[model samples]
Target: MDASSQDVARALLGWYDVHARDLPWRARPGCAAPDPYRVWLSEVMLQQTTVAAVKSYFAEFVRRWPSVEALAAADEGEVMAAWAGLGYYARARNLLACAKEVAGRGGTFPADELELRALPGLGAYTAAAVAAIAFGQRAVVVDANVERVVSRLFAVAAPLPGARVAIRRHTDTITPSERAGDFAQAMMDLGATICTPRAPRCLLCPLSASCLARLHAEPEQFPVKAPKKARPQRAGKAFWIERDGAVWLVRRPGKGMLGGMRALPDDGWSARANGNGTPPLMGPWQPGGVVAHGFTHFGLDLHLAVYEGDDWSSLTASEGEWWPLDSIDDAGLPTLFAKAARLALAEAGEVG
Candidate 1:
């Protein structure tokens, strides 16, 4: 590596050795790598999620299913339930699939980046992260934090999605062949703590002397982003049918929005379209209220319709179960459905 690149990696690793965040999945700098299972699981859970939000979930998951084999043997429904409220339901499904794949291969994760990528649902970024953090391989690990750090350090003015290629190249130059795992984690810690997106603490940054954007007095402006498109607005309906102090819930179709989770029956709303299917049974339905939720691509206003009739025969032929009102919280409903259920309960005087 070039002199400047060598200096950059050295300074950052030095800082990381002293100031790395004490995260649940991390090993002490310069120590043996943590369990590959923990590394892989944390990386997956942290995707599109924050550290504060993932800690509890990661702890609970490892507590319940400590290894790839344990997770592989887990029921899909239970796993999905455990993953409730984490959002990105697809990740939970993919997690199960990847676990099964690893279990079939004798429960040992592959050390090579490409082999890890071949596993179900494992992407380039995740594979690289696992390779570096779990196996101490020298892979270019550029997560969002690393992206910001690299963009600012080099002052790359190109907007993201296009700037990523250049960012990765720059990251490669500075990634030391040894201690690459520590180096990668150092970059992440530096970005997250010192070179923040806004009001960066440049004065305290280890590489502030080499930061082009800091020199320009605009550290936050380096990882330039294209303007965001407006998220689409979607409307849908959820039916809440209560009988004998219990509410009727259905397992959503195994492959769609909020798939494989138990939820209040809806009128078949989708990401691409509003709900239009008929309610589960003929209802002299009362307007309970509306519950608003945001997805990655759209915002939804799910209207709630409570069944007012005592129709028992029609629901018998339908596919659903009666869950006790007091135990509704244990049903593992997605956030959207959970919100809908709470609104329905409040409207029915079942909950305040």
Candidate 2:
């Protein structure tokens, strides 16, 4: 947008040309076209998650679904199961909605970053990521990586939530036109690997000479933020029932948390609930250990109770069914319920 911004983008792109990682979403020189679907999927999965953690999830998802239409047609339960352990369960929900929408529109995601932002889960960062990486759009993208890179280069001193606007404004001025994708990746890689929050490798950075934080000898202090508030904890109960070789899993409500995911049948999980309580299910329920799950907003404590009997009772949803608790991996549970299932089976000795 401005002269200085253009300079920053140029330097970052040059550095990226020599140092960028050969990521899956990228097209190799002289190879075929880069898949927009892969770029979109990876950007969606990488929200608030690290690249290291997303690699396997990305590969598995692409392997399983292969296309937007396939993902759209997939059962919400299957998507939830596939997404288990990747954390940010809400992203999974939005992923389904966005995918279905894309399918309904004849399965074509808009190449423009702004239009991409309108999709269910695609935020500013994700939209920029997909647009620049997949469509080579000249969009200024500032993820955690870009934030660190920007903060250090400009020596931004304002506290976060408050500083977001200024940072975005600054970034908007610098994004380059050609090879915009590589420039975006470069800033991210620089922040992630070299311009780290702690003990940045200044001497190794290409822009070290221009880095204000390095000049001031305080790179760690850039991108300041307000102190994080303590997350409150909530308690609930999960009913793990085993009838035979199959373990019992009920479909979670299709609207709320972990909606449409396969889980050990649960009973009313309010923010306030009795820790020592029986779920609204029939059979002899034994007390299993609790399963603790950390969410972005709060921590949840699930008291896993085991029921071993022939009666299904009212616990069965219209579509709820039984599976060998041992076959949970095949059922596709998200991380929360998967952890509960493991705890329940271990405590109830169903796995043995």
Candidate 3:
């Protein structure tokens, strides 16, 4: 690395020694490297999720499954239930798959980024993070935080998704050969605290002396992003089949959106091109209003269709279980379905 790059790393590391965030998954500055399990778990949980949201979940997960092997052996339903309200169901599934793979390999994670990438559900970003933080490997760990920090440091002007390549190259230049973990965490802390998306505290930043965006006095404009297209809107209906103080719940197909989780029956907007908003069985259905939900690619307006049929035999023909109405919260329903359930319950006067 060049002298200027070394100076940047040194300054950031020195600042980190006294000003690092006390995250649950992170080891203290200059301490021994954190456990690979903690690093991997925290990294996965932190993806598209905030540190505040992940703290309780991480603590609960570690409390229940103290080791990777224990998590691998956990029941799929239980895991999905535990992961409810976390927004992304796919991450929970991948977490199980990755844990099982790690457990199968004698409960040890690979130190090499390439080897970690080869494992189930371990993506490029995750592998690099695990290698750098867990194994002290001098790998380029460019998370969203690093992306923002690096983009500002070099005054990258290209819009994101396209600018990622340039950001990675700049990050590589400043990544120190030793103490890669500390450097990675320092960048993350810096971005989360001082180098915020709006009104960054550039004067307080450790690398402000070398920051190109700061020199230009326009750090906020460095990480330029392409305009986002409006998300498509979808319409669907969910069946709220209540009989004898119980609600009918079904397991979604094991491979699509909200897969393997318990939820109310619905027109397949989640896994189809278009939904007709038809009920599962022929019935004089009552409208339970609409529940609007947003996904990564689209937004949904799921209308609730309450089943009026009294014949339990006809309902039994379909594949589902009748869960107690009072204990609906215990079921691992995704946010969309959970909102639908609340609407249905309100319509039924079951909840205030």
Candidate 4:
């Protein structure tokens, strides 16, 4: 590393020693490295999720499955149920696959970056993070926070996706050989707290002297982004079939949107973008309400269709179970289905 880069690393590390965030998965600066299981688990859970949201879940996960072997031994269905409210069902599936792989290898995570990357569901960002934080390796770990910090530090104006290369290069320049773990965590803390995306607290930043964007008086503008394409809107309907104080629920097919989750029967949103517009049973049917939900690629307008008949013929070909209405919370439905359920309940009340 060059002299200037070395100085930047030194300043950041010095600041880190006194100001690292106290998190469940992180060891304090100057402390022994954190457990690799905690680091990997936290990183996976924190993907596209917030620290505040992850804390209770992280604690619960560790409480239940304290080690990689424990998680590996867990039933996939139980894991999926536990991960219900946390959206992005694919992550839960990948988490199980990755845990099993780690446990199969004698319940030890590999310290090498490439080896970590080869694990199931360990993407580039996650692998680098695990290597740097859990194993004290000098890997260029550029997560979203690090991306913003690096772009501003070097005043790189290239828009993201394309700008990622330059950001990685800049981050590598400042990352020190010593205390790689502390350094990585420090950048995450700094970006999250001080050099935030909106209204950065520049005066409190330790690396302000070396920050090119701060020097230019435009820190927020450095990490420029390309304009987002408008998200497509799709329409669908969910069936609310109540029989003898119980509601019909189905376990979604195990490999698509909201896969392996229990939900209200819906026109297969998983199979197609636009729904088939077919109701589960012949009416008399009443409109429960419309529940709006946003997915990664699109938004959905889900119309809830409540059955008004003692129907048995239409559902003979379908597979489902009647869950007690009072205990619906235990069903572990995804957010979209949960919303639809609430709408159905409210409509039922209005009718009564």
lDDT of 3 by residue, 75-168 (tens): 9889988888886778888999999999999999999999998876678788888999899899999988899999999999899989999999
Q: Pick the candidate with the highest lDDT.
A: 1
Collision pairs in model 2: 1-173, 81-332, 84-334, 246-323, 246-324, 247-323, 247-324, 247-325
Displacement of residue 301 (Cα, Å) in model 1 is 1.1
Ranking by lDDT: 1, 4, 3, 2
Q: lDDT scores for all predictions?
A: 0.90, 0.80, 0.87, 0.88
Give the poorly placed runs of model 3, Cα more than 4 Å off: 28-33, 270-274, 350-352
Native-referenced Cα lDDT, model 4: 0.88
Query: What shift in Å separates residue 324 of candidate 3 from its native position after superposition?
Result: 1.3
Better structure of 1 and 3 per lDDT: 1
TM-score of each: 0.96, 0.90, 0.95, 0.94
Worst 10 residues of 1 by lDDT: 343-352
The CA lDDT at 118 in model 3 is: 89
lDDT string, candidate 1, 282-324, tens digits: 8598877989888988999999988889876787635988999
Global local distance difference test of model 1: 0.90
User: lDDT, candidate 2, residue 13?
Assistant: 75
lDDT of 1 at 80: 96
Which regions of candidate 1 deviate over 4 angstroms? 29-32, 316-318, 350-352
**Candidate 4 residues 127-188, lDDT tens each?**
99999989989898889999999999999988998999889988988899988877888899
Residue 309 miss distance in model 2 (angstroms)? 4.9
